[model samples]
Target chain A: MDSRVLRTRRDVLTAAMDELVEGGWDAVTHARVAGRAGYAKATLYAHWPDRLALVRDAFDQVGRMPHHEPTGDLRADLVGELVSFRTAMTEHRLDRALAVLAERAGPVPELVEVRRRFVEDGERPMRLLLAPVLSGARLEAATAMLCGAVVHATLLHGAPPTDEEVEAAVDLVLVGVTGA
Target chain B: MDSRVLRTRRDVLTAAMDELVEGGWDAVTHARVAGRAGYAKATLYAHWPDRLALVRDAFDQVGRMPHHEPTGDLRADLVGELVSFRTAMTEHRLDRALAVLAERAGPVPELVEVRRRFVEDGERPMRLLLAPVLSGARLEAATAMLCGAVVHATLLHGAPPTDEEVEAAVDLVLVGVTGA
Candidate 1:
């Protein structure tokens, strides 16, 4: 794909997300998104072809944002992950858009696949960081708990966490895993 | 209230919740809820003058379900709370309905009061159980983390936890707090 085309697709996706947050998922029609992006409807169609595809691509972009690198220290890694999760929840519209999409997706297979991809991708780094600290079932359980907590704090509370809060939560989870 | 009237009101709320889960918050209009309950719109109105009041009452009823008693075992109590939270998320429509209502209420004093009451009621048992295990800001932080994790698991994953999952998560938090 041409760089310009990629850039335009990003623009349209970003614009669509803005509309989604501003007016809920119902407002994210192709025409509205195109209008918001200052692009013609034909241009959006040429790039995405379907609204779900557009949404999927946008969420994919969100899932790929740079995350904190694990430092081989479990507590530090967890704190870093919590901080990143908090920042994404607070500063990014993608989390809100994802919540709206998840509610509306229902049993739509394509949307379900997109959601799975989004969640797996988002969880990948955290899982890696936590792997060394936990074994077998404990690792899996801890990962779920961490991801679940961060997402809940952000989406439901509408507030990103402070460093102190993140640090405290990390400590709690770490003690569970290490029995420190 | 007459026992029969109370039963009928409960039926109405249950129907409204079913509609909410089946078709999101918008599907729970007074007429549809009344229809689902086999009651006339006027009957619903007699019970609740407005949809907000009805939703508020329904949520309050749902929220007031008995919490797990603190077993003097911190891990056990926390696990019970997590399980109950998961059950509420999966079995009741109140969470989604509250999300919709929150948007509508948006900083309104009545809504704020309702929210305060909800949080206080939910947090009371948690505070009591966790107090023996944690103190100061750590107690509050652990409670928030546990609440956030359970809610996220329910709302985002659509999975109410099994006892095993609840025990695992609670173990993680409690171990973390106690060990730290």
Candidate 2:
């Protein structure tokens, strides 16, 4: 893809995502997205034929917001990443939009693949952060628990969570595994 | 308030819950619930003026599932409760049904109250289990993480978690707090 085309695509997708956040999945219709992006509906349909395609592109954009680079200190890095993700979830409407799309899509293969990729992408940094702090089975369990807790706290509670909570959760898991 | 009337009301609500699980929230219409329960639409209306009321009653029933009594061992009790809840979430459609409803309702005041009640009920037993093992703020954080993890594992992953995973999570939180 040409760089300028890629940039325009990114802009269109970003506008669609904003519409989704503001008005739920129904708001991401090509017409509305194009209107929001100041483009004709034909332009959107030219790039993405269906609602799902548009949503998929919008999700791709939203899913890339997390900075997954790992720092050497597993706890600090994990906490920082979780806090950042949590802040985005709480402050931005995108998280709810993604969740709504996921729920509404049901068992569609494309949506399922998108969900799985989203999960893997979200979990990748945590796994890396944990690999250094833990070894063997302990690392696996800790990573699952940490990621599980963060997702639960943000999605269910409607807040990004505090550093203290994240630190305590990480410490709890690490202590149990190492018996330190 | 009559005994037979109360029984009929309960039956209608149970049928509504079944429909919700079978077809998700959108399927829980008054006529469908009435037909499923072999009741007249008038009876359903008498008991629940709206779909939300019927769904709310069903959610209450689901929440009334058996809870684990504290056994003084925080890790054991926490793990047991989580595993049991995970099983219910998987085996009973009502559990997932209510979750779907809650997510759709978002931050609406009535729905928020329902969510708060759900979390409190789920966390209360775990808190009792952990109280002896932890003190002060650690106890609060531990309960939140444990409860949060279980909810996420079931709702997001759509799988029944094993006792081993629950044990690992409890151990992680317990060890961190007690430094044991």
Candidate 3:
């Protein structure tokens, strides 16, 4: 609440991000974070109760990345959604967060819920945009193909698609899904 | 090694998987795994000196999931590859392992190398199949979309696509990519 308190929280989260980027999510622990931030465990605990809480707080720093508003032009909208997805991944560090969430190999119910929330939230617009145009398995397949391609192009290639590249990808997905 | 040594290794690996699935990759530490498997830290350490080593040893239990051998029939091979990928995701627990690897959220160099190796290995067949059929940027987009779609349909849909579904998806992707 106060300036010093806010500053400490900022420092803690910056360390959390540092840990997250440098070592991955598993590396973010209270003791490790306190050490990184030069704070006492008690002080860190005073603000956040546990590792998940701390992780959530650190990620929540970004809150929700922006989603695109559909312009009622199907092709335009598709390209827009893909561009937005790429932007969130590149600029907002969504890909890194996703990588961290994804590596939970086992069936932790709460973590599953969290992962679902993040993924569904990220692709919500894609679903909504495609809803009116397609349905059932076709829509599901289309959503997956488009979003998946974006992921591949972005994370694997490690670059956001240019507008022309995005348009080209959209055309490929569109023709494939629409089949016309 | 002796039978007793082999059994100890098996038990440690099993506990690592349990921790991986239940608590994620980070949860697989020597002390926790030793406790879980009812062994001493020294025993676990003797087998695996660190967490990554332990994680690698556990995952290597399912190393190099069977990739599809490319059939000459492009359509048949595409379907086969997609089906094989779906099988790997479901039967081999590759999805769980991938999730754990994905959530690291940091830029740990070795881990990045490991992740790249896993992703590339899994999709190697797809790339090889597409190389002659497509080239340059088209080839890249095609690979991403095809593999990306398989990931979505497999992981997000949480079911292996039926032959019909896989065919439909392959057809959609094929048309989009080949444009014929």
Candidate 4:
């Protein structure tokens, strides 16, 4: 709870996150993080017992996503939220992190719960946007489609969706084309 | 090539794949794979010259996906193909592999090409199923949605869809819900 100790903890977590970004999950080790943070290994180990514990603390240090106010116009709101989502992903290289987490989700209950919490938390804002228009499984499915489309387009195809593509996706979810 | 030589190549590739699955992309070093395959390091180097080359060879050794013949029942056929896709993913642990590959795709042209080829080759069969019903960007968007739905449902949710969920996803694509 001491001010200097808090600063040191912040510094260490920042270093761990830097390691994660620079080299990936495999690169986060106590000694490497301690060296980067200008701390003795003993200091890091005294604070966090293991690498996973350190990673969890580092991950928690990431800024919280700000809640978006709905713009009342559905299309504008959807695009705004999606663009914000895309920006966050780009800034953090989150697609890679998500991939790693998703892969580990199977064997690690901690990760599975993490992903579940993420999905639940992420959908909350979208739910507010769609509350008037959509509900239940259909709403959930639509949200997944939109998020998945942006993710695949950005990560796999190497670009964010064109405005046209975004509009098309929105249209499809709102009311699918009839007769094929 | 001599039969003995062919056997050695297969053995080496198999060993490399096991390492890839067990340890990840970082674990595919020539020394480790060669040792696992009972070959000297020189043998691996003589063939691969680098870790990336060995990985490509190992990835290529994964069994080819069997082409699915459409049964002409649109809904049934789509479900059948999706179920098959899900089965293949499970058998090969493909979601995890794809996560790793997609993360590496930007910097690695080989991986990009691999993903491009995979999308092209994988979509060919789906095209046959959809050609009668749809075409153009609509077709492409529909395919991506179906694939994404299956992927998120299976990989993130940790289970393949129930028959009901698959049917619902297909319905949403073919004729999405009206009024949100």
Clashes of each: 1, 2, 15, 0
Candidate 1, residues B1-180, lDDT tens digits: the string is 999998998999888767765666567699999989998899998878876677667667666756786777777778887777666655654455444433333323355555556766776787788787777656756777777666555555555455666677777876676577
Ranked candidates, highest DockQ first: 2, 1, 3, 4
DockQ of candidate 2 relative to the true structure: 0.45
Could you give the TM-score of chain B for each candidate, in order? Answer: 0.77, 0.86, 0.78, 0.84
DockQ of 4: 0.37
CAPRI tier for the interface of model 1: acceptable
Candidate 4 chain B lDDT trough over 10 residues, lowest sum:
B171-180
Better of 3 and 4 by lDDT: 3
Interface RMSD of each: 3.3, 3.0, 3.1, 3.8
DockQ of 1: 0.44
Candidate 2 per-residue C-alpha lDDT over A108-133 given as tens digits, one digit per residue, 9 for 90 to 100: 44666666666667667777777765
What is the C-alpha lDDT profile of model 3 across B47-135, one tens digit per residue? 68888888777766655788778769888898888888888778767677666665542443455566666677777888888787666
Expressed as tens digits, the lDDT of each residue in A1-180 for candidate 1 is 999888897899888777766666567789999998999999988878887777777777666856888777777878887777767766765456556755665534466667677767777898888877776656656776677666544554444556766677777787777783
Which of candidates 2 and 4 reaches a greater lDDT?
4
- Across B1-180, the per-residue lDDT of candidate 4 in tens digits comes to 999999999999999877776666778898899899999999889999998888787667764665556888887888788777777667767665655566556445577766666656665676678777765665656666666666665555566556565665666666742333
Query: Fraction of true inter-chain Cα contacts (below 8 Å) kept per model?
Result: 0.41, 0.35, 0.49, 0.25
TM-score of each: 0.84, 0.86, 0.73, 0.83
- Chain A TM-score values for every predicted structure, listed in order: 0.87, 0.85, 0.76, 0.83
Cα error, candidate 2, residue A122 (Å): 1.4
- Residue-level lDDT tens digits of model 3 in A17-107: 6677567756889899999999999998888887777877776665567878878998999888888888888776767766665554145
Evaluate residue A7 in candidate 4 and report its C-alpha lDDT on the 0 to 100 scale: 97
